[model samples]
Target chain A: MDITDNKENMTEAPVLLSVRGLVKSFDGKTVLDGIDLDVRQGEVVVIVGPSGCGKSTLLRCINALEPIQGGEVLLDGQKIEKDGKNLTAIRQKIGMVFQSYDLFPHLTVLDNITLAPQKVQKRPRREAEEEAISLLKRVGLEGKAGSYPRELSGGQKQRVAIVRALILHPEVMLFDEVTAALDPEMVREVLDVILQLARQGRTMLIVTHEMQFARAIADRVIFLDEGHVLEDLPPERFFTEPGTERAKNFLHMFEFEAVR
Target chain B: MPDLGLNVLLKGKNMQRLLSGLWTAMRISLIAVAISMPLGILLGVLMTKKNPVVRAVLRVYLEFIRIMPQMVLLFLVFFGTTGAFGWNLSGELSSIIVFSLWGTAEMSDLVRGALISIPKHQYESSEALGLSRSQTFAYVIIPQTVRRLIPLSINLITRMIKTTSLVLMIGVVEVLKVAQQIIEANRMASPNAAFGIYLTVFLLYFIVCWPISMLARRLEKKWKD
Candidate 1:
């Protein structure tokens, strides 16, 4: 689809996940309040905001990694959280990559990538190994299977993490500032893996400050201000012409480079 | 008796006693550590919770175990508890109970320190993985905790072996006690046997603890490497 047509069609895309009235408080401070969000299947939705605007907290709540005091997270139009516990069956469909690569250092790179599948999914060793090899290739690190995480560079470790998450074959991937901790030059390599994933039409919900990444990747960009969405617009409109005063002011932090 | 000291090694009687005593001590240590380390790890994990009341209660229990002497604990279990409660109990049983309690409390605190010493980002990253709580513990948090745990546990085993001497006070025939008995019986006829017997006991204790210490050091160095 063309850029203009994609923009017009995004509003009509079927919602794959829906959230409502999410609230989270820590030590008498509200980190998230009355937040609502929707993500369409095969769409990349990037949540952009300044530090401490609760963007990360919002991403966490959606995956039930961080419990919400009040709200609902519906995946495929069904509630993922029932009573108190997060349904593992549902969580299996959503994977997360962190700012710091949490690769298991004790395990070999192949083992680290296959651990979740072997343990959680009870997949056979041969099958899991095959999947891990294919995922390693997909992330452009097939040669590093035998290397330990400590032996790899930060960018390589992050790429390994992306592969680890993708190995689960989740319907949605959550990226929480995945390249925030890397060297400037290394950030591109990590982002390039993500950019490749985007080109494959993987559904993603990302919380990031990389305005250029948000502009280039996101089908829709969400601007959050103080635990609420200030503006939700198509990337072309959101970057070029943000509607709310808060969106305009928040974009100023990106220095208009995102637009050009 | 001039050549008898070295000749004693050829007879193997002393070796038998030494092996038996050492084996008994090792058995006690292995059992104590096996039971206590897991308990301690669980306690340590619970101690780090965000709840203030839970932390305070665990703190009191841990400090009490730490401050009270393990020997006194043995005396209380063997002598005082049997008298106070009208229950028959053996000294060996009491020794196991006291040592396990001591080992557990110390091990638990070590576990807590190791787990907490890990950077907070590690836990956060696991959470970000959408791993369930059990999965997080099994996959991410525990592997790191256990690597630190192995060396610390070996050190605790060594401590437990040395501490088993205190059990002799309540009447278990451990190495030191056997040496004391042999020395007491031959005191008049062989006065220097006191020195010899005690030296033998010292060597026995040294043999028991030295290998474990080496093992602990090797593990620590390997993990570091």
Candidate 2:
């Protein structure tokens, strides 16, 4: 299987997740206005925008974490709704990692990873523990499974958080700035884990500020401004030949920061 | 002048009566706690519900309990209920009923605060992990809420114990009422008995409440981590 061939086929790939005319509002103020997006299986879609542009809210709406005021999110062509009876089933297929690494403070890393599997999936405790250890080892956290979230550094906590989501074997993962809260040095370890997942052909929708990482990993980059998609293109074209002035100015700021 | 009241307190049957009165007070508080704890937790969880009607009703109930004096509540339940409804409410039962009402209101508020204080991310993360609402509460929300509530609830427990002395006003013959009886009996023989008996009552309350407050403080420190 040629890597370039797979990339070429992405345009016609079957959609694993689809967002149609998604709208969200908080206290009568719209945060996400008529947004649309799609993620093909094993494809990486990165969303970039300035602060408060509704980037995070879009990811939350996709997972049904936020109630949408209008439109629908479909996973494998099935509607995701706030009041859906099978929300847990729908959510099981879409794992999310938060920026703060919301690991259960009372639970150890291993327990945190294994909790959903044992409790929701009804997997045996021993089986869940074995799988958790393997996933932990994959992230180079094999020895830290016994540590609490507070005892770990920001990077370690985020890695464990990613592993916690991965153990559920979600078909698509939503990463909401998983590195935003980390120190400069710690961001790499967490990003490396995510990059490794991308290498393993995981379907990921990421909202990130790391322009370089977004450029490196994204098959398609979406530029959002003021709750609307300003541009959606391949990273190469998005960086060099942005179609809109809004996107161009956005990229120009990053370029100026890079030189400084 | 030389602490004659102390002798009256140690006289024939006065000490025994006080001990029994203390027993009555302790028993009433324990029963009230046992009933209120589960009831309060349920109400607290209910208070977090999104339904406006339920919230409004619970809010009214909480405010009513908070604003009404516990002594007045005891009177209403004991004498008023008997007079109005013709129901036979024993003094001890009335004391339990009134305290349970007060305890439930206080406990529910503590629980609500604990539940709300949990960070929003905890719920979101649990939901994203595919845990059902019940699973989220049982495993994620409840554990954190319980840790936060234990110390506060323990403080409420001590408050309930101290407040049980109010039942004496309704003729329950609790420790304070027993002390009053002893003082009245020894008015001619032991002029200073009131001072001695009241001191003993204070010490008895302190003995019961001090350890509990200490325990709450220690727990608050331990769970802070």
TM-scores for the candidates: 0.82, 0.90
On DockQ, the leading prediction is 2
- What's the residue-level lDDT of A235 in candidate 2? 87
Candidate 1, residues A102-161, lDDT tens digits: the string is 787777789887877877678898998999898888878899999988889999999998
Report how far off residue A120 is in candidate 1 (Å): 4.1
Tens-digit per-residue lDDT, B160-192, candidate 1: 889887788999887777667665655665666
Residue A101, model 1, lDDT: 82
Q: How close is candidate 1 to the true structure, as a TM-score?
A: 0.82
> What local lDDT does model 1 show for residue B208?
77
Give the clashing pairs for model 1.
none
Count of backbone collisions in candidate 2: 0
Q: On a 0 to 100 scale, what is the lDDT of residue B26 in model 2?
A: 98
